[model samples]
Target chain A: MKQLTIQSSSHAYDVIIGAGLRKKLSQKLGKSYKKILIVTDSKVSSLYLEDVKAGLPDHENLSHVIVPAGEASKSMEQYSRLLDKCIEEQLDRSSLIVGLGGGMVGDLAGFVASTYLRGVDFLQMPTTILAHDSSVGGKVAINHEQGKNLIGSFYSPVQVIYDTDTLRTLPDSEVRSGYGEVVKHALLSDMDWVKEVLSEDFSELSYSQLGDHLLAGIKVKASIVEEDEKEHGVRRHLNLGHTLAHALESDLGYGEITHGEAVAIGIFFAMKVSEKVLESTLPVDAYSAWLKTNEYPVEKLSNLNPERLVNRMKWDKKTIEDRIHFVLLKGVGSPAVVPIPEDDLVNHLKEFIEEVIQIDERD
Target chain B: MKQLTIQSSSHAYDVIIGAGLRKKLSQKLGKSYKKILIVTDSKVSSLYLEDVKAGLPDHENLSHVIVPAGEASKSMEQYSRLLDKCIEEQLDRSSLIVGLGGGMVGDLAGFVASTYLRGVDFLQMPTTILAHDSSVGGKVAINHEQGKNLIGSFYSPVQVIYDTDTLRTLPDSEVRSGYGEVVKHALLSDMDWVKEVLSEDFSELSYSQLGDHLLAGIKVKASIVEEDEKEHGVRRHLNLGHTLAHALESDLGYGEITHGEAVAIGIFFAMKVSEKVLESTLPVDAYSAWLKTNEYPVEKLSNLNPERLVNRMKWDKKTIEDRIHFVLLKGVGSPAVVPIPEDDLVNHLKEFIEEVIQIDERD
Candidate 1:
């Protein structure tokens, strides 16, 4: 088992990762909680709910809430329903909520735990590679109708237990989607790590190799989260490509594109933007080629309107006054938040969209 | 102005009390906020909204949302409507929310601020004396169908500015309601303070006298909240009369009885419970007489079912594993959490009910 502790002014918790580590939950929890509420999704529950329950300590009473599986589950309607279940089950401050699935379950469960009775103890049992990023930094949120992750808070978990056994059940597409965040983490952390991740064989990578990459991603997130728990400063670096990524997801309609896919496109655009604004040697075309090899939707920008996408970006939570800010990469491992003038941003986006469409035609 | 600082692990903020302090808000907050939302009830807005708006700095953009007055405004329906207004107003992380009314308004506004975009900077411009207690400790909540404050969290405000000028517009009933929380604070803080308050004339007390008492109440709350921010330990003492107070309000159907009136009855019963359980000298009858003089509903116990009330108390957020806990006074300024045997609680409550009914019959 690989274990690390994240310490902040508000809270401190351990992150444990290994194969079949979910079984150690009760032992790790020390049977301290009076009751445990296992929050999972339909798909995840059918696969591992009973096994997760059986792994819990006999001393602690357990209840389970199964939400719908997918991004759509992270809605206010679902959040309220989950809170209703929390009340129905009589879960109190002494109780524990175990998020027993991927990023959606983690975000939803963490948010519910944060607000229920003014917050309670929550444990994260991440079941996907994507959750390695979500589970670590304690950024739990439900999507607003107007924008993605527009309603959320910084609430740390009591512990995060990542079991590699759960990832084996994920489909190839889901795995690829998760890999996109891993790439973001790698690019933000170090150029060597980014190069290592790019060169790895996605389909045939060994379990240990995947675990190593996920751990590195978590470490990068943890360090940044530790420094700026509230996202007031250095933490914006983690947004590397999320500004346009959020716009893409909101404009195209959520669930039409996977978060990681949108992020992949955003990262490519950010690199191009970096080349224009910072004169950085990021090799945007080579990165696009790598994304294409991974079956990412790099060519989708051909059908999108630059103006519309820019308008959507204006409504992002990160916007300052009337100015829109983008977290662009100066180079691999070097990210900065720069306010692009509206006209400059539109022209650059139009040029970038045309270039992406030409690449699509050439392919 | 009398100012006291509430220091908690999560946050520390100032509680400022004075007449006409609301007008000083612009000077105090500076012009840093992107926008401000003034959340008040219709009754308060009709009387003070424009003046409150005039008090804001010209550089700071401000908006207002007036909710319905009275306890019904604390309902989940109103809470959702308030959230909708927050969304409509485009409140971002840089925004400020000024809760500009009584306890209901403070609770509702604080809750909305706590959750809106995962929390923003919120100030408490409490218009009622009742808010002397609610506005300080950051215990903001909306009511659930099952119970009061069932859906809530401990989110501290940036500052609490209690302008006694607004209290002049409140009716005698509102003043009495505000006084109950003041009494709770006195009972929890100092014995001499309690005796002094009990001997004071309710209707004849001057504005400055009320402000002095309110300041004392705020100090008591600040000290306790400072010691235990999250209510994990000594904070339960702050819930002194709240458990039964919640049950009384829930049983009597909310708007039919005010929060402080319910708390008044709860305090009287807790004293009786203390006399029975701890063999403490509390002079419950004298206190009951004082409550009666203040026009508090001391005789409402005549209509309530002890079994149902106990059942409701069982569902209180403070309960642990089916055990109902009550914060009972050992004497003035002394409180402790005690688990009453089910039969004993019901029997004592029945006895208490009989005594209250006899008093009602005599009247």
Candidate 2:
């Protein structure tokens, strides 16, 4: 088991990564909380709710609330229901809420916990690699109908327990989706980590190998978060590929494409934009080849309209005075925000989309 | 203008109290925000929304969202609508939300501002005297059907601008309601202030006189909030009469009774309970007389069941492990948390109800 401590301004918590640690949660949770509500998604509950229950303290007051699986669960409707469930179960300020699933469950549960009775103690048990980045750094939110994660807050959880055993159940698509964030973290952190990741076969990552990569990503995130918990300065670097990523998700209609899949394509566009605007020295083609080798569907970008994508990007929280602020790389591990004029951004996006289509036709 | 700064752990902001300050808000908010959403209730909008809009910069992005007046507006339904309006209006990270009304408007808008886009800057323009207390302490929340302020967080506004001119339009009942918090603040802080308050005719107080009292109340609140922002210790003392006040409000049903009037009765019972439990040498009869003179309806408690009221108190955030924790006073200005046995509390409440009836009949 490897444990990392994240010291944020509002909270300090541990991100515990290990195999089979989910079963020992009750002992880890201690005896302070009188009421425990385990919130999981339908998919995760079907696979691991009983095991999670088995791990909890043998107290009759312990209960569970399940939200439907997928991105839809991260809505205002679900948030309200979860709050009602907390009140119905008599969960108090001292009661604990354990988020037992992937990113959706963690985001929903963390948000509910943050707003429930003002705020309450909550634990995150991330079941997917995509959550390795999300489950840390205390950014929890539900999506609005207008956009993804449009309504949310920065609320840190009490602890994050990533049980590697849960990863065994995830589909290959989900695994690839999780790697999108892993690749972003690598880009923002070190070229050596990026090289190490490229050297490995993405399809056959061992549990130990995934754990090591996740911990490295979390360390990069934790350090950045500790410096700027509210995203006043350096925290914007974390949104490296998210500007285009969110636009794609919104334009494509959320849940139609996986978050990491959109992010993988977003990273590609961010690199191209970086080369055009910042004169970045990044090996964009090499990274593009690596993404294709990992089976990330970069070819899907050809189907999206540049104008609609740019329009969607206009609504991003990072946009200031209608100028789209893209997190561009100067070199490996060096990310900076440069405002792209709308006309220029639109032209670049159109060119990139055409190039992606041409490359796909050649292949 | 009387200004006091609140230094909470999460945020530090000033409480600016004066007449006609709402008209100067645009100049105050300055160029920092590109979008401004002025949130007010219908009553406040009818009276002051135009003045508020006129004060703001000549920016087309400024908008207003009005909720219905009163406690019913402090619900999950309204909260969801407010969020939707925020997203629809495109209020971003650097935008502003000005809460313009009574306690309900402040609570609702403050909560939306706290959660919108994770969190955004908000200004509180309090229209009621009760809001002098609510608007200062950074405690923003909407109500759950189960309890008053059952779901909320400690999110302080950037500034609290209490325009005393707006108080002229408030009904007698509203003024009385605002005094409940003032009396509680007086009790929690200074005996001299309490004596001075009791000596005044609440019905005929001038604007300047009310401002003096409100400023004193805010100072007491600001000092306590600075010491314990999250209610870990001394901050709970602020909830002195709130325990029974919330119970009575819940039992009578919110909107049926004014919060301050209920708090006035709650204060009477709290003192009686304090004397019975702690042998507190409080001038209970004198305080009871002052409440009657101030037009507080103490007779309302005669209609409530002791057991029902106690049950509602069980749901209070202050209640711990089933033990009833009441903020009782050893004497004036010396409040302390005292856990009473259930049987003893019920018996005291029944007897106190009888005493209030006897006193009313004598009057």
Candidate 3:
């Protein structure tokens, strides 16, 4: 098992990545907290909630809360209902909360644990590959009616248990969806990994090999999260594909497209923009070919309206003073945070849209 | 003008309390931010938005957002609408949000400013006396459908401008409502101030005198906020009256009573508990008489259902693992944070209700 730590002002938690780590939680937590509140999604609850509950020390008090599965569950109404559950269940300051699911569960549960009773200790037991990215960071929040994650706090979990065994149960589509985020980490930092991922056929990669790649991705993300937990400076680089990705998610209607799928298309657009703005040498055709080989959506760009997408991009949480900032890449593994004026971004979107449409029409 | 600073990981802002300090905002902020988004309730906008706007340095970048007046406006729907407004207006990272009004506006606007683009520079331009408490600490949040402030963050403002001149337009009930929070501050920290406040007739305190008390109360509260920005330890003391106060607010329905009025009754209950639990030497008769003199609902406790109030208290954000903790005072100015087991709290509630009913029947 490899152990990594996330240090933040609000909390410091260890991320343990290995097989069969779920059984060790009781010994790991000991009897520090009086009781434990385990928050999981319905999907995870059916799969591993019993394993987690059995793993806890028999002496410590425990209860479980199961939320609906999906991004739609991370709303203010759910958050309020969860708080009511905590109160009804009598969770206190000395109690601990274990987030036992993927990123949505982790974010929602972490947020509930963070704000309930002002704050409480939370353990992240991420059960999906996507959580490899979300679990390491202490950014806990819920979505508001206005936007995603509009209301939340920066509360870190006490420990993050990434059991590779959990990934075995994930659907193939989920695995493919998570690869987008994994690719994001590679694009932002690991050129060697990016080259390796590009060269290999994902269907041929073994489960252990996939775990290794996920670990590598998480390490890159963890390093960034460690330095800038609140997305102030260096952390912005981690948002390499997020600019267009978030816009696509909002424009397409959130939850309709997986986060990773949007991120995949976002990375494609980001690479094009990087080539244009930073004069970077990108193997665009080769990259596009690899994405197509993997059956990823390599030509969805033609379906979206450039103006609406651009407008949606303006609402990105990272924007400042009417100016939208893009985390562009100078080269693979060389990311730069750049503030592009809104009009300039819109113009760039128009040009990119026309280029992609012309290519699709010729094809 | 007296200047006080609250230093927290998310926010470091100065509290400038004095007459005519609104003009100093432009000088204080200077060119640090490119634009300003002033968020205020309709009542304050109609009265002082122009004066506050005039205080700006003629930056064509300045704009304002007016929300409806009252706590009802601090909902997730409103919070989402505000984010849409920010996106439409192009308020960015370098933008500044100025919250102008009472606790409702401060909490709602502060939450908007905090979450807008992850966060931006927020200033608290408090138009009501109650904001003397809300503005200092960066406890910005919007109410969720299930409960009050169920979704929020600890994002502090950049500066707090408490213009005493604005208090002249405040209704008498509103002014008295603010005194509840001020009295809470004094009761929790300054025994001398509590004595002075109790000695004087409520009608005798002038606006300037009240402002002085407000500043003094804020200073005491600000010190605690500086020590514990996220309520890990000392900050919990700020919720002295809030335990029962929040329960009352929730039970009676939020719109039925102002925060201060609920808090005033909460303080009375807390004091009673203090006398019971801590065996503190409290002038119970004198205190009850002072509350009566101010037209505070010293007898309203009889009307509330003890069982319902206890049930509602369970939903308090401070409770953990089904245990309710009360912030009780050992004496006036000697506040203590205590965790009460569920059964013990229930028993205390029973006793408290019985006493209040007995007193009401005698009257």
Candidate 4:
């Protein structure tokens, strides 16, 4: 197992990654926690809940709560229910909340743990490929009807245990969704890394190879998060494609598109806006083609109304003074945030949408 | 104006205490905030919202969201509604959330500010004397149906503006409720403070004299909180009268008694338990008499069943391993958290309840 220590102003914790690490849970968790609540989803609970519980200390009071397995579970209602569940289980200040599923589970559980009894000991045990990115940063939140992750806080977990063996069960679609973040991380890095990610066939990779990609994305995330845990300045760089991603998620309804799939689609527009607005022009064709080849469905952009999408972006949490902004790439490995007036962004977005349709028609 | 700078792990801010301090809001907040959402209660809105708004910069896009003016307003349902309000107002990351009311408004608005857009700039403008304690220490939260402040976090505000002028318009009951904390602070300090608090007449204090009392409580709270913001060790001492305070509030229903009033009664029993358990015995009769003379309904304790209140204490957020704990004092200024097993607590509580009835009948 490889352990990467994450440092924050509040506390420092480890992200332990390896194959079949679920069996090592007790060794990491120790005997300090007076109570432990394992929060998993309906699907992961049926599959791995018992197995995960088997690895916990027998003497400790262990319990589990499960929500349905989807983004819809990341709601204010679900958050309230989980809090009631924690209270029902009598999880106290010394208790531990084990987030034992994927991104949705981790986000929901992390948020509940963050607020229950003010805060509690939280351990993230991600059961999906997407969580490799989501679990590392301490951005725990639930969705508001108005926007994705509109209600939340920056609460670091006590530890993150990413057992690679769990990834073996993810569907191909889930795997591709997970790679949307991986590719975004690559784009944020140098051209060589982006080329490497584009050339790679994610489905065929072994657990070790997959771990390498996950580690790369995590390293990028951890490095950025360490610099600014609360997203003061440098942290905005990590939100490379999430502006449009959140807008799409809010407009389409949360469950309609996976977060990373929306992010993949967002990256295409971010590149176009980057080229048009910034002096540094990206080869938009190359990036779009990479997404298309990877089964990311970049054609989804054709279905959007530019003004509506840009209007939706107005409510984005990252905005300032109600002005819309985009994290545009100055070049590969160099991203800068530029505030575009709503009218200007709508115009640029219209051009981008036409280009997406033309590219779809030509192909 | 007395500007006490509160130092915390994240950021240090000022708690400006004086008469008519609401007029000083913009001078402290300055022109940086692009947008501001003032969250107030209906009562406070009628009294001070327009007046408070007058102090703010007119150039900024200022808006207000009003919650119902009571403890019932401190619910998950209200929290969800406020978040929607923020989204509707389009309060972004750089915007500010101005909490304008008593303890309920401060707590609910503070929680929303802490979680909205992950977090936003929060300014506390307290309208009640109880908020002199609540607004200062960074303990922001909303209530779960299971318990009071069962869901919360330690999020400090940018600044706290406590206007003594606002206190002039408060009902006599609200002023007494506010003193619940002021007197508790004295009990947790020393004999001199306790004596001073007992001798003081609340209804006649000049704004300056009241500010002096609020400053004393804020100093004690600020010192303790700076030492332990998340209530790890020393900070638990600050919860001296709160164990029974929470239980009574939960049992009687939230709106039945004001928070400080319940705290005043809780202080009476806490002293009894402290004398029974600790080496240093308190003059329980003196404390009970002071509470009775001060209009605190200490007799309410007689109505409660011992086992039920003891059971309620088990659900307290301060608990560990489902064990009952109390911030019992050895004497004034010396408090310790003791883990009392259920049966022992039930017996002790039974004795205290009987004593309360006897005192009530005799008087």
TM-score, per-candidate, Cα-based: 0.95, 0.98, 0.83, 0.93
1 or 2, which is superior by DockQ? 2
lDDT at position A341, candidate 4 = 84
Best by lDDT: 2
Candidate 4 chain B worst ten-residue window by lDDT = B314-323
Off by over 4 Å in 4: A250-256, A273-289, A320-323, A341-344, A361-363, B281-286, B320-323, B341-343
TM-score of chain B of each: 0.94, 0.97, 0.93, 0.95
Per-residue lDDT tens digits of candidate 1, residues A117-198?
A: 8788889999988889889887888876666676666788989888888899887667777887898988887778877877
lDDT of 4 by residue, A1-363 (tens): 787888977888888999877877888873477789999999998878888888887645899888998888999989988998998888888899999999999999999999998899899999887898889879999987666788898998999998999999887678878988998888888788887777767656678878888888888889998988888888888788888888787777766677888888788888888877886767566677766676776566777888888777776745744467678899998999888888888888788779877887786
User: A48-76 in candidate 2: lDDT tens per residue?
Assistant: 88888888765698999988899999998
Q: lDDT values of the candidates?
A: 0.82, 0.86, 0.77, 0.83
Docking class of 4: medium
What tens digits encode model 1's per-residue C-alpha lDDT throughout B1-363?
A: 787877856667888888887777787673478788899988988888888788777544688888888877877678677777777778788889889998889999998888777788888888887888888877888876666677777889998888888888888777878888888888887778888777766778788888899889988888888888878788889877787888888888877778787787788888889988888877576677787677777666777898988888877744565556788988888899988877788888899889877876687
Best by DockQ: 4
Tell me the lDDT of model 4 at B155. 92
Model 1 lDDT at residue A168: 91
Candidate 2 scores an iRMS of 1.6
